[model samples]
Target: MLNLTSPILSDGLTTRSISCPNYSLRGFVNPSSKPRPLTAKPHQEIKTPHLSAVAANATEPLLFSSRAHERDQKDRRDQKDKLVVIMGATGSGKSRLSVDLANIFSGEIVNSDKLQFYNGLEITTNQMTVQERQGVPHHLLGEVEPEDGELTAAEFRSAAARAISGIVSRGNLPILAGGSNSFVHALLAERWDPETYPFNGRGSICSDLRYDCCFIWIDVAPPLLFEYHSRRVDKMLERGMFEELAELYDPKNDPGESWTRIGLWKSIGVPEFDRYFRKYPPQKTREAANRDDWDAARKSAYDRAVREVKENTFLLAMKQIEKIQKLRSAGWDIRRVDAAAWFRSALSSPDGDGGSGGRRCKEIWEREILEPCVERVRDEVFCLGEKQMTATYY
Candidate 1:
């Protein structure tokens, strides 16, 4: 009799004999052309059970059943769709955090900032500078034209899904970062719709319409935001924001001919022009090119530009912050950073302005933006489990 518990071998002979050590048992041996184990040491030829045979019968009810296999497949399917989403108020250092996290996680940063989507308004919109990208790969930035006219959050999410699929295909993590909170969540929580085609023959398997990732929200308090806004404008002026704006605004030309100014005031033309002009005053033509007058006029324009940019930025920041709060309360995973703290710190750091003051600015970012962002990304890694997690999770 075959022992079902014993390992299956190619030979039919059982390893355990029926005869006991104390009691001898006699059995009739069949005489056939094939030799028995007792005769000529079983006339051997090297042989083994075929692995293909075992595999072929693996799904049979005799050993394992297809139901268990199907269950495992379903479990894998569930895990495959899991995704992470990042959201926050703009200028709260979401981009900086995302870029850093992308480095550690070996993931690509997917642009969720609506302003970043446009191509022409690169400097005005403050899209990532080429040097700032540090040779790191990115997706979805500068793909849309300014003329596209108000690309919705829904549309951005759709583009995101396609980007995600391609990233997944390459076995890389997709770091969804930007200020478009609603759009990011919509992709993670929504079901796939047949009509929505996000990939357009790209490697992505899903439309940008899907949302299926963890959500990370960056934020700052209103008071801190106001301070940060003012300082950021100051930094921008130092970076020649006034010069850039002046080049765009031609007081003498028709409005249609100029580059559209981005951000709060929208443009630098007409009726409500005081809103911007007060901060970015135009220069008066000098009777002659007097160096002192020209220097003074330029300085005034820079100062005014700083003030205008700050005021408008504060208003916009407040509105964005309100949205962030609502999203957080609604059960989204939101991580907030004190941008004012960061701005203050930046004001003091060597990279910021220059020495003792630079240290203060750097410290503020450490307390507010950098530390919080690092913690948020770490939490994501913990959720995925450090053993199975890759750099992408962080």
Candidate 2:
């Protein structure tokens, strides 16, 4: 039997010794008994006798090796390219966590959020700023032009596949991150029959994945998530979301610029503000004079639009959560990390307070969400214990 004398090293090397009863070296002869004098001259090449029998019996020890050999065989049999997928609702910090994991794993992110595919409207779609990305390369983010029209799921799968291949070629992990579960489903599903199983139909999107996936699902309580979404909409407005939309609100540029049309205009905030923009044109024409009585009406319309944006955002979060649940039910081994406590603490803390509340919330997030996710990803990449692969919420 082969016995591991010490713990397996972190580098996967083991210090093992074989212990067997009546196991002798078959042809290991004692050179001392032969009394062969070393008569070789200095710096001369010495020829030693080859122990062919001992060399032939070298495989005997391995035959009695321990479970480590079995484990190595299993790893070889199941070896597949690894992929990390980060999924969550709108305000659940999926983008932030993806960035963190990519940094940890020497990874590059391939965005799956369909809304974030278009150029401009960064605030409306909540695309990560270059500064916020912290220099980690991101793919398919704001690469599509507004006039280029909406990208289909199949098209996204093709583009994302190329990006993933490129990232893998550069010896980096590919992290598929965003709230667009449809794009993710498109790219990861092994066999998708669009005709028979329509995207929105009750078809089972099986998890016969193309790559070995480590799915990290960030979950927040619905009440806390809704409250967080409402606050985030207000934050977006403060960050000049309205002004950004105003710049893109040129109905004269294209007759098909309506929110109902397929394209960047289909974003939640863009459509909701359509009426407000019509009532109060961003650039008032000289022919149009503003009356004092219209001021109250315009303000009311603007406030109503903001309310609708918040409501629509909440609904979108709900739909994203439902899709994630469906993915879990469809045989995907998704690891869920609960950030509801983090959200509650963050919501209670005043924004820009520069106090311990903000720091404490960050601590909670790292402990409850980020650290667990990092551990899970580490285990997957290293082919560690199966106990770490359990589908339990952290």
Candidate 3:
């Protein structure tokens, strides 16, 4: 409001002037505004970028998604593609636990055990029955063609990637469960031993697919696992294990144990029983009911074969444990679910009927193994993620 007297001093400045454009330095002020002279203190306009409301208020790690709906949808899709691997040595109850996880999580089981992938000899392969699955959808089981030969690890990765993508598209979890370490590893890791697989290591042997994987290792001590293998062999015999072995490795027909020389045909039960087949020669021994000495010798050979199978299974289990630990070292997310205490509790507890003990074991499993796993998947994989990880078994 510098209503200065006109022409007081043409060059004299007023104390201050604002909104009084009727005067200037020379006469009142020019009717238009002009720049004020600079001073020692500077005036600056401060501005800060806007932050997301959720992020600004959050106390924990924030999971960020795009502002656009389409980007949100893509984020959701990526989250859904998370892969769950249930892995362990032979007779570690991987299949059983996998079924439990899948059934609880609305997941579909993908067979990773190479033997279970074969269509023939469901008995020898130790395939789980529909009842055993308890209504969970399973994939890749009994899908392999015998004539296709052993599927190379690379081919398995391709197939698994496709299956996982398809499952995620349908809004279901893909649960890969079995003992096929290299095959499973191929899908998750960039590098693997190509020599072990059917394909030669050409170039990088890399699969272009990747997934956020949760690897669950169903673990048991070696001695306990060997006992399971022995008992499983005996049960297999009861369920026509030798018959499948006979068909797969008949000494008279194939003669040279050619199956033993092949790749996956060298699976656990295959090699151990090869010698037994040669010695007893299933074809000759099957009709030897009239000879006591021959049957007795065959019985001796059967025990020996079972013992060898158990021993080899123990060795294989050790290798599997070693491999699993190695994979962990290579940054694979591995969590071990110990079954020893649970088995002991379930089998030897009071009520002896085992029903209550089995139920208790299930409870322990839910509390210890399943819940923590779901939390890990939520925190690590999803961030209270789009998939809405829920308690399945409980």
Candidate 4:
């Protein structure tokens, strides 16, 4: 019978013993010692190359084991196939940030804003200008025709999925940026439950995510955000927003019925200006001679419409914020970056302050919002070399 026993030596090393019945050969093998030939000639010496020497002398490329290679491929796929979602209220700079991140990450943006999806009403929907896009490719922005029909959440999910797949197949990051929470939920949630899809408040929506996602929430204080929205409305007006609406307006169509049409017609400024447009038809307003009471009534109606746009915009921002809060409460790992300071600075700065105020606001935005978000995205996507990025609640 052959017997084997492993015993701890005095040096804390494990040694194995082999024994036989007829001819007992007892030896202690030190596992940590260099391996030796089982049998050798009387006057021969065996030399083994040192590990470093072997590596230095090797001419062929080093190869990973089959298992190691497979693991490496999986890691590469995980690193490449990631989604960055930017969610926030209107006028929270979501579009600008998306463009900036796409530039840094070599990504393509997929727009999720419901209103921005439709064509026309560029100014009314606050669509980004070609110059403002900074040469980054944006998907689904101004792609839909309002006269066609309303775009459902499911349809958006399908289109967005295809866009993301194409972006990933081209070895580019897919960045979904917008304030359309319903579309966002529809796309990212693992399973769809129509009744409680967007804001279940029960934390069921994000229980299982469909993709590896990093969500960024650009947050601002309510008062400052509302003030910023008002100022933005004024800027849009200056940029011929009313003219864009006028081009779409037709005296033959009923203002109330036209406003009720799905898609672009439902945009904030469009419906809000219905009464004003009806009262003062574009052509008639241009042809009518100046009369005190008539002009006064037209001006009053115009002012009221403008005020309604601002008020409705404020209310929309509130609802967007509420939905975002509900999402956060429901276990979405949303990274919040407060932008109230930047808004306050921009709002307080005197108009036309030699461009110094604009520069200062940009600096603040970079420091407070952009840099942190970049770091977070970097950690989420590229930091896989060191550790995996996992969602953290709250």
Candidate 5:
């Protein structure tokens, strides 16, 4: 069997390897041999062995042997072209799952989230914090263009395709994770013949690269999902999302550009939150209302803006679901995993009087939702990389 704990290390992290069905019934191989505990090794290069994809189906294969694996690695080309598509609506925990999956499979994250592709809107876009990233390498986050140009779907696919190739060439998985339906659809879509149909689409599936890609669709129960989104927006506000929007506001822009200072003003929460920044002017309005003995009026306006954001975001998520169905219709492989299960699992954990309970709850969430979802992907898709598969969770 291949050794994962050898000299190869990932920026002070271990890239745990998995075995086929024989390694465990679930296709996981825990590297029992411990290498020297990793210390700070900044600027050190990571060396990982290339893993070839074995034939996948109902059929079983021989147990892993070093000689056999080495020979297969030399002869086969499938392992060099694996891709993980982490997608779903906003508030469904796509970012969290991508981070966890990348850690397990020694993968890098390629951001396809359209808003995340821009700069200076990190909090507004719900960009994953560095601490939340868990030390995995992330590419294409905040890769904006000069002069605030409008980024087309094709442009993003080109960038993401390059990033995917580099990750695979390094013997690591390439995880395309985000909720940008347009970008995801464009990247995985069937190659279009522009001469035959110039207007339909110019999107390329990049089939020339021979990637065996599968979509891990993270979902949340609708009722619970709305609550999740509301709480998430509240958290964003607490973290100064309002201030971020205020900094980017410009009343002189055409009413058509009511979103923000730049072209990406159409991002999910931006348009909805525009009211709070423009007409409502929360803090200023509050002070003025205090003089008139109507401070609650300012609070009411802010509350209305928050409600609109929550409702509009829900509508946006529903539209995304429709778009995803179109991809499913076009025969893209997708696996659905529910995030409400994780949230419920976390909430159901024992509670305490202090913030300790909240921290412990997050631990429960990782153990329950995040880790298992990645393991399932390892077993059902990545380990058996040749299958065109689909599974649904509600």
Candidate 6:
């Protein structure tokens, strides 16, 4: 049988095919450019230039073998494809540690935080900085518009999967980072199944549903979560939350496919209040009778926002804790770190009490929270790689 691997094709004619008599018969030869006599026979021996030399050139085999070796090297490099999904309740420190670990592991940050995907409101959404991104590369952060309403967990998972693939293809580790617990769980497991319920997207999506991926839950406490959220909103306000909210109000600058479709335009819904305020601007002085009415309306809107924040955070915390328990029972590597340690690690340097304060917090984080998570991810990746190798060998 002919060796199909060889580049040369052999015919019944043993002579070089290029010098065949059929070539002259077919008018292929340049008679003026070559010697007058050209010899060819249909059944004669044909010796292609490389045919007689391939056996002597060991480099040819070496080049062929190099392809397999190249694949092996690529496999080794991509063995780090196993993802470390950092999940927590709202106000938990998922984003902080995710970014830090990404830096450490030559990884890319996939934002699982829903709010942080918007175009503006960096402070309000707590989006990462260019310096923090550090050419380390982050995906999905600041990629959406504020008006885009109620992007479901399914949408987040799809975006995350694409982001993860892009990261892995570029030979970087993918760190799924966010405080949205459902987003993290769903992406890791690839289970988009939401609970069957009455209203649209209202029912809880069960994390126990089967999926081809993995889930890691970062356990956090309630009190710390409350405090973190309260402080976060306060900080956002101090950092010009109103200005960002105002910018989103332009009737002409319509942000289609945004949270606005679901009627969630502004962060605090303050723009809605602003609309009210504009319709009935506060009169110059208390002499105006309707001034009291306007002030009361304004305060009511603000108070409503505060109430909403508090209520939403509580419900999210409860749901997230339940999800964590489910993932743990489902044979996932769920690591519950010290809540205080995780909370402290989220403090940015300037926000830290002092240099020493930040350093101490960093030490605790590396020792208690982050190190263990990294170890778990590495172990899982190695185990999966071993399984794949065993299957290939068989």
Compared with the true structure, all predictions reach lDDT values of: 0.51, 0.71, 0.61, 0.71, 0.60, 0.53
TM-score winner between 1 and 4, please give it. 4
Candidate 2 lDDT tens digits, 158-192: 67777776676566778899998877887787776
TM per candidate comes to 0.62, 0.74, 0.69, 0.74, 0.68, 0.59
**TM-score, predicted candidate 3 vs. hidden true structure:** 0.69
lDDT of 1 by residue, 1-394 (tens): 1111112233221112221111100111112334222212222454666977777777754445699788866654544333445666657676666676666545577787666665644555667887788666777787654444555544554566666655655544567777654455445543433344322332222223233345566665666667655666566555655455544444554335433343222532221333344444545322322436556765575456456656766776666666666656555555554465555555446544322454455456556665555555545532322332222222
Q: Which stretches of candidate 4 lie over 4 Å from their true place?
A: 1-80, 194-197, 200-204, 255-259, 288-294, 350-356, 384-394
- Model 2 CA lDDT for position 55: 67
Worst 10 residues of 4 by lDDT: 16-25
> In terms of TM-score, which candidate is stronger, 1 or 5?
5
Higher-ranked by TM-score: 4 or 5: 4
TM-score winner between 1 and 3, please give it.
Answer: 3
lDDT agreement of model 4 with the native: 0.71
**How far off is residue 61 in model 5, in Å?**
31
Off by over 4 Å in 6: 1-81, 146-155, 190-216, 250-304, 341-357, 382-394
Candidate 2, pairs of clashing residues? none
What number of clashing residue pairs does each candidate have, in the order they appear? 27, 0, 4, 0, 0, 13
- The full ranking of all candidates by lDDT, starting with the best, is 4, 2, 3, 5, 6, 1
- Writing each residue's lDDT as its tens digit, candidate 6 over 127-216 gives 777876667677777766544445566566556666665665555566777765556655654334544321134544444332223345
lDDT for residue 99 in candidate 3, whole number 0-100: 72
Per-residue error (Å), model 5, residue 182? 1.8
